[model samples]
Target: MKKGGTAGTGATGRRGLLKRAAFGGVVAATGALAAPQVSRAQTVTWRFQSTWPARDIFHEYAADYVKRVNEMGGGRLRLELLPAGAVVPAFQLIDAVHAGTLDGGHGVSAYWFGRNKAFSLFGTAPPWFRDANNYLGWFHYGGGEALYNELITDILKLNVVGFQNGPMPTQPLGWFKNPIERVEQLRGLKFRTVGLATDLFNELGAAVVALPGGEIVPALERGVIDGAEFNNPSSDRALGFPDVAKVYMLQSFHQHTETFEILFNKPKFEALPAELKAILKYASESNSADMSWKLQDRYPKDLLEMTQRQGVRALTTPRPILEAQLQAWDRVVARLEGDTSSPAAGPFFKKVCDSQRDWCRRTGVFFLRNEAPSVLAFNHFFARG
Candidate 1:
């Protein structure tokens, strides 16, 4: 009986050991199955710098972009945001991104007109489109994107790729110490602007000083410039333009519409997984739409505040000055199209210009015929006596 009990006990111990081993094997298999997923979860991090001060709405836009990308990436990708001067000066963003000193950058293409005249076509050129929507349509669908890539990658050979965002509204004519009632007043009035508008202003006989927004107020206070236009009312107000000089011309053709450039190093961007690349590109478009909406909502209130609270004298720019700007743009475009000094100047610029002109011709007609007269509407609803 004792021998039989020992045999049964030994058999039971062996059965328990087998069960334990089988359970261990199952756990091991499960871990093996999950290993690839764990490895795939490794995160990719990128550093992005913006050509905007910490307080500017441009920086806020940049942050929003990073936020969307991060949430969409779901821990697989992360982007770090830095303000202007974080990596380099605001204007050096293109070069820094190209050099891989920055993983990415946000700025306006017009800031780099010194590199290639064609860049102005992507930025704040003269009044070619009726509004930001029309301009962005031309950019996305009207062959502007291809030409932009050719200029950045093929023509200039910069090791970067870019997208357009921040569909800006028509910029103000800017702040002046004295009211500009005639086109003649622009002559020799040390002015501040950027992009092709600089050339246009210079053509109109203004000694144009191409300074960034941060420097404009100081320049104005020191009497270094007689007039300046940075962007919208809020940004200009934030920069203290109202304190220094108060004759705010409420309209202009110099930069009727503009967009921001979002740049990434070519090699770095290519190294990203396909999904991540799409996220970066598509997020820019999303941000562009969001920015336009925000501007429309916020700018009107700010303009009113500047007038009602800050006691700013906002006046409509004279029609003669607008006509003069159009003439100056014609001359500037003619000179750019005719010059062959730079390889990318003549044909490439003309190609972009021709595309925009065709789009403008078609779309402008529709806008004029189909849209209600906005000036009359404004006069009816909001015009002050």
Candidate 2:
């Protein structure tokens, strides 16, 4: 029910701007990679390894992105996408890219939070940064992007090419074997989750495990984990989570929009002719838009099909479970704020929450009532166009 896409593109009504303004002239001005004619003669090929599994929507996005780039470049920029473990482990994409072993890589920006907790603030957090629009606004228009580039690129010195990959658009809470009745239900539960969810889950006395998508189903099926949360209905169902765990709870507060990032080695990016630089960015913007659109269309249908056709148990997280999670989230976030050791993620989270709360107070409550009509109208508009 929420929106997703490239920053400044999709449901936001900025497609025209992206096409005509964002990089229209930047590419031509960068004389090095010049017209597609010259680059096409040489056929510059690059390797792009991704952290996502082949079936993941985000992975689909990456594949589509490579195809589009190849087409648009007219045979100049050919990219070979290697799945996780092709070159480096799934979780080590940023490191691989930073090391310049590959031309570029696709991964979630916050997964590198271990390098600097501040990266977590850019991704997602519980009881905060709920809306996709708010997150985009903060990153692109607010000081968030400047702060991020400053820290990650300027300070940490990693070769970074960043773009927002997903909104996972209001994900399901998780699949629970038993209904969560209260805050205590979370206690001692081993959950496969990540980011701020891990901290929040910890506060509720749950142990959090960070597992790749491929591993989640096996872990849950084999009883290595009590419960788990993945992407939207489409992705989870595709991966067979519904078959393994029938009780699918909705509205996970932990990851409102799990942003996927594409990073390349800085030196590699810099070494490219300015024209290739512009081309890559333009290609990224287009691919990102396409990726988000697929989710916008598929998620709703998948959720409906899962319940109606597959007999999967799909329902919202109980109010009590959500309420309890909120309490624990607040406490944990507050404690994080008070801790000076590394409050980067915490304070940035507070700002994002403040912004979202203020926006919701002004417009979101009323907006929700009109969403059905809006979705219908918006869908028709895009379909016809």
Candidate 3:
């Protein structure tokens, strides 16, 4: 009887232990189901475009910006870059981005000059900057951003966010069918240029035709325009400028210093996480520095190739013409400053130009005075003895 009783007790205890174990298992599963699950962040993709033809170095520069952002973003963010005219024409980039047709774009601020002439003050007009780098310094540090915000938000009412990057070297006087030796040569010349440079050339007596970079070569080929300027040597070579024009006139005050503008839809950009926003900002900075280095390397090589091998005659634009361009800029500034009409470039134009000029007075003068003429160093080191 004692052995049977002990066996029954052990059996009962074993059953109780098994039931508790099963209950513990159910509780663990329930806890797991109730607790938050860990998963990867959802990847975001932006449809981006460039206001440049596919082959142009400008487009490549745009690609560089996109690459930096994408790699830094890892899988969390992706930017798909399309060439100009993929979704909208190059000039319409701001509008498209504003309307969410494109999430973002690479373009110059000057492209929006039609909306407000003050747009040119950001990167396209005046010779106040000692160089593109100085121009960028002004934009980033010299109260330019506040004014820019005012223009975009308070004035133009465009639903966009923009960052200024890609400091362009001084643009050339432009391409010509024949070398221009005199200021008089500009009169009645049909020239292709965009931005306030169009007004500058127009001021100098050229019948200005504002064509996008892609159309310049074709227009030149068809005799639709006689001369054009499209940024630097790599882009000029890429766009077949040599095939159409033999004389490449270098240096100009029109777009003395310029930078590319990277724009985003305000809503879309704001919707991004703080980490991603920081990525885009840093990416712009990275792109700017990288492009500066790359242009220093590539532009000289192409310029040499054009002059040495391609039978292209590259000439320094005559002093007379440059002085005349400066004068023209003065006139353009005055006219725009005086006009208080539809675009409201009058007071706004004065405001930006005054800011730039004050910044230049404090900064650019120092830069010019402190940096010895680079030509002297170039002649000392690289001059063929």
Candidate 4:
């Protein structure tokens, strides 16, 4: 039994050594084969179009979003930024996205209010919510997202993605040639506004015109409109509003927080693999965060500069006018609620407003009064700075 023991042991050791060598070789081959696949998976390209001017911060957010996505995706997703007029007419962005003519676009939600008055609720309102955090909370956690996506995917049948432009701050009521001291001043006053606000403005006996970003300046120049509201102070000044109009009034009560969107063609979005869809969603949310921070810092500073540099006079909105406007808005909500076609919109609107109001009453009052040190610390720093 012992005769061949040493010889058999040597043979078994040799076979074991060969098996180890084979496994090592197979692992090396697998590593080599997988390397290129991993590299190839790191590349993707997309295009984003916007109606905003290339120089506007609103558009700047779009550019930043591309960079953030590319970085966060570790070079897997690449988005190319296209200024207004690159893919389609700036005004036709919503249509382009819906038709799959373009990948996606940057546009204000109010622009599509023509599709339904209920759509305007996402943007802003007269005598409604003002704080940016409240607005963000409404969209993300207040059932607004569910209602919004359903409105697009279920009702309009488009694959639309949206994000916050954040609150544009207390916007100037508008550029006006005369003081609107009396309610009578509103009658026959031509204003530029979109959505259900137009109906409310009409009810107040004022004429409202819907115009695109490019058209507003020309219309103001030509006296097509007596007053206009485009955006915040910096944006308005950039558009040369000061040169054309005399009075820069305070607080866009009608637009406390206007939400904007970047809509994608539903079919195109759905066709993507799950990972790519995720990349898009993360990109949008990241964009919202970045934009909110920037605007919060930039808006108040810009307004201060306007007052100091341009000699812009800030007119206060009369309290009575604001109260009456709120009353009228209540009627607008009630009338829309009675119409069954927008049943979802009615409850959704009420819920957001109620939530926002509750937050305002509980926390907002102290913040505005500055009774609590932590209250509105961010707003105070920015406004005072």
Candidate 5:
């Protein structure tokens, strides 16, 4: 009876051992699964560069975007912001991002006009009959976003994803040794501009030089460029434009509805989990709204400072010159629309232009009919006695 009991106990012990080993195997399997989850929890950092120098207000705008992304990224993603020329020259930012040398960047689409003239259509040229904000309605509600994607993914074949924000007002004609009052003064003049505005000025017979923002003031001082325009009053003041030239040409058709572009390397951008991607997109949009509001405050204040303290002569571009600019645009459009033998706008440009015109033509009727005339209102409230 005792021997039989010992054999029974041995069998029970074997069963117990087997159960323990099986439990250990399940524990090991769970730990293996958990390892990947832990790996995913690690933070990802992106190297982002801006095409504006650190001192420029545009760079502050870039920083505003970075700050929003960092705060909203939920510790899983971080952006390390660098100013222009940190990773590559401002003009070469798209190329650097495309090659994966830089993870992302902030710049204007017009900066890449060397690659395709159609790029200018995204932001910088062919001023539609509305303000920059009104035109951005076309970019978002109309087919502009899709065409912009096609330009990047299909036509230009750049490995990038971009969003355009920061609707700038009508750019100034520029600063010259003397005020540019007549269309005739543009003849044989040396001027600086970018994007299709270069062509616009060229048709007016000015020798147009394309320089980045940081270089514009220096070029003007060195006579490398005779007269130049670099965005707005704040940026121009920061670039030391008032020190070099006193005449600040207030408004023009050139770059009348420009915006800033924020770019990401497509593969890198896609690899981000959907949450982080959403953060980036929403961050761009939020920054855009803030920029439009902030500029209203900053631009007016800076213009005041320049005019009141800095001996700057802020003059409206003459009516005749404005009319001439419109006529020049008509000719420029004809050439780009029909010119297939060269790298002018051609078919793809037509697609973009036609889309813009379609949106503008439909919306412009309502705008022209109902839009308030601000000049009369301003004169009533604020004009000097």
Candidate 6:
């Protein structure tokens, strides 16, 4: 009986040991399955800079883009935002990103037009489109993207990839100390602007000063410039333009439509995991749509404040001045497209210009036809009587 009891006790001990071993194997299997997830949780961080001041709405747009990218990345990718002059000046962002000093940057393509005239074709073209939306459609649906890549990568050979963000509204003619009652008034008026507009204004006989946004107010205060156009009403107000200049011209053909260029280092962008790269590109589209909506809401309010509270006089730019600008644009376009000064200039500029022109011809006709009734209805409904 004692021997049988000892044998039973040994049998029970063996069964318990086998059960614990089986549980251990299950735990090991679970841990093996979880190991890859732990590895994927590792984070990747990048530094970004913008050609906008810290308090500018453009900076807000940049920050909004960063926030969206981070949330979508699920903690795997992080982008840090720095305002203008953080690492380099506003116009040098493209070169800085190309050299890898910044992982990415936010600016307009026209800022680097000196590199190639084709940059203006993408940045801020003369008033070819009806509005910013029309230009954006050409960029996305038209062949603009391929030509843009050709200009940036193949021709210029910059090691960077760019996405177009925010489609800006028509920039004002500018703020002037005295009202411009005639096209001739523009002659010899020292003006501050950038991009192709500088050339256009110069053709119109203004002494164009290519000053950055931050310097415009100071230049105006110091009598260095007689008039200037920076961006929107809010930005112009914040930059203190209202204090120095009382006449705000409400329309212009100079930069009827433009968009922000968000650039990434080609190597860094290529090295990113496929999903992360998609996030970077798609975020621009999302942010651009959001920005347009915000602008629609904000610009009107700011314009009201500028006129009513700031003791500023707002006037529709005279018809002759508008007509004169269109004529100036004709000359500028002809010069850019006909110049064989740079081997890449004429053909590359024509490629982009042709694409935009073709799109404008077809799409613009449709817009003009469809928009006429809307304008009529709007006028009838909002008649000032």
- Specify the highest-TM-score model's number: 6
Alpha-carbon RMSD to native, per candidate: 3.5, 16.8, 4.2, 5.0, 3.9, 3.0
lDDT of 5 by residue, 336-380 (tens): 988787664788888888989988888999978997998989999
Q: TM-score of model 6 relative to the true fold?
A: 0.92
* Evaluation by lDDT, superior candidate among 1 and 4: 1
Off by over 4 Å in 1: 1-41, 377-385
TM-score each candidate: 0.90, 0.79, 0.90, 0.80, 0.89, 0.92
Go through the candidates in order and give each one's C-alpha lDDT: 0.87, 0.72, 0.90, 0.72, 0.90, 0.88
Tens-place lDDT digits, model 4, residues 1-385: 4658877887888998899999999999998998868866867666779878776676777787777767766556677789878888777888887776777888777777877565777766544453655666667766667767766766666655665554545555688887787777888999997767777777778899988666777798899999888878767776777777768878545666676677777777777778878877877787777777887787778778777877777788888767767776777777665655575456555654565566456555665686566657877877784
lDDT of 6 at 223: 97
- List ranges where model 5 is wrong by over 4 Å: 1-41
Evaluated against the true structure, the overall lDDT of model 4 is 0.72
Worst 10 residues of 5 by lDDT: 127-136
lDDT of 3 by residue, 128-236 (tens): 7888888888888999989988999899889999999988899998898899999888899999888888788888888998888899999999999988898999999
> Model 6, 109-191: lDDT tens per residue?
88887788778878598788877778888888987888889888888899999998798999999999989999888899999
Better of 2 and 3 by lDDT: 3
Local error of candidate 1 at residue 182 (angstroms): 1.3
lDDT of 2 by residue, 205-306 (tens): 988888877789999989999999887887787888877877888876777766667776777677877776777778876775676688878888988888
lDDT of 1 by residue, 1-385 (tens): 7899999998999999999999999999999998768855787788999988877777888888888888887677888999999889888888889999999988899999988878988967668788877888998888888988888878889999899888888888999988999988989999999999988999999999988767889999999999999999878777788799878998899999899889999998999889999999999888887887887777888889889988899999999999999999999999999887867479888888999999999989988999888799999989878
Question: Which is superior by lDDT, 2 or 5?
Answer: 5
The collision pairs in model 2 are: 159-266
